[model samples]
Target: MSLIEIILVGIGLSMDAVAVSMSNGMVYGTLPRRKWPLAPLFFGLFQGLMPLLGFFTGTLFAKYIDCYAELLILLILGFIGGKMIYDGFKGDKEKAEERVLSLKLIFFQAVATSIDAFAVGIGFCAINVNIFFASSLIAATTFILSSLSFCIGRKFGDLLGNKAEIFGGTILVILAIKAIL
Candidate 1:
């Protein structure tokens, strides 16, 4: 793909990550105060890296992964989305502050959101583009979009109050479902 095309793909690919990051912002209350940078950082890191890894290894590994990729994405994202939905519905407020945003949660969100990029890498094997340039643009675009979306989502979430978490969780679940179909 051309540079513009690559950039467009990056933006298109990042929509889910953007939504999740925004949800992260929306549900920021459940998380700790000091970890402000965590949302965009994790999203951006995985967004950038997954495609690169996929491009490098996809040709050799695609068949092995194709069989299980959808299932894995469904499970991981479903579990996380389910937990968020469950957490949003609970009555206790104290537990809310203590739980959520676990390392495992972060890891899963990162990987789950970036699965499309992995697929893109698989497609890249058939093309003759500059891998580094494409990957870098993709990563940078995701970072910028994810970061901005998180900030905006957080602001809106704050306005929406407690229901924001539920909404965020719902968004995740929807995205997860969309990924598989």
Candidate 2:
């Protein structure tokens, strides 16, 4: 993948974390200044780490799918993007609104949100790109976006809501189609 595409994928993958960060911000809206960055920091860390884990795991089978890499990329990206789009239309109403935060809770949220990045790691292998570069781009983009979302949500609470997911999802789908042509 090109550097630009990798960055876009990072942004796309980050949407989920961003949404959650925003929600979490609002949930923990009353926190002292010192604790504000924790959630997004954890989110960024997991978002970065999960893809690396996935890439290494996927690297184990890279030889097997090398010949079919292009198709595999399409399959993975399409599936992920479609899921994101479907999730977007569903809206945010179904999610629970609760206050209070803990490290365990943050960890749980980070892992849950970064699960998609894990799948994305698998796709990275299909493209035969340097895992480090791709994961770094994804991680950096996720960090910036997640941090912004957390602040926005913390201050504003559920403003953009699910639209962010749809945008992110669409970016993935577009990139997937681009890979094919």
Taking all chains together, each candidate's TM-score versus the true structure is 0.90, 0.63
Which prediction has the highest lDDT against the true structure?
1
Candidate 1 lDDT over 52-122, as tens digits, reads 88888967888777777777778877777777788888836775566566667777888888877887887
Per-model clash counts, in order, read 0, 1
Top-scoring candidate (TM-score): 1
Name model 1 segments beyond 4 Å from true. 29-34
**All candidates: CA RMSD in angstroms?**
1.9, 8.4
Pairs of residues at least 3 apart in sequence or in different chains that clash in candidate 1: none
Task: Return model 1's CA RMSD, one decimal.
Answer: 1.9
lDDT value, candidate 1, whole model: 0.80
Return the TM-score for candidate 2, rounded to 2 decimals.
0.63
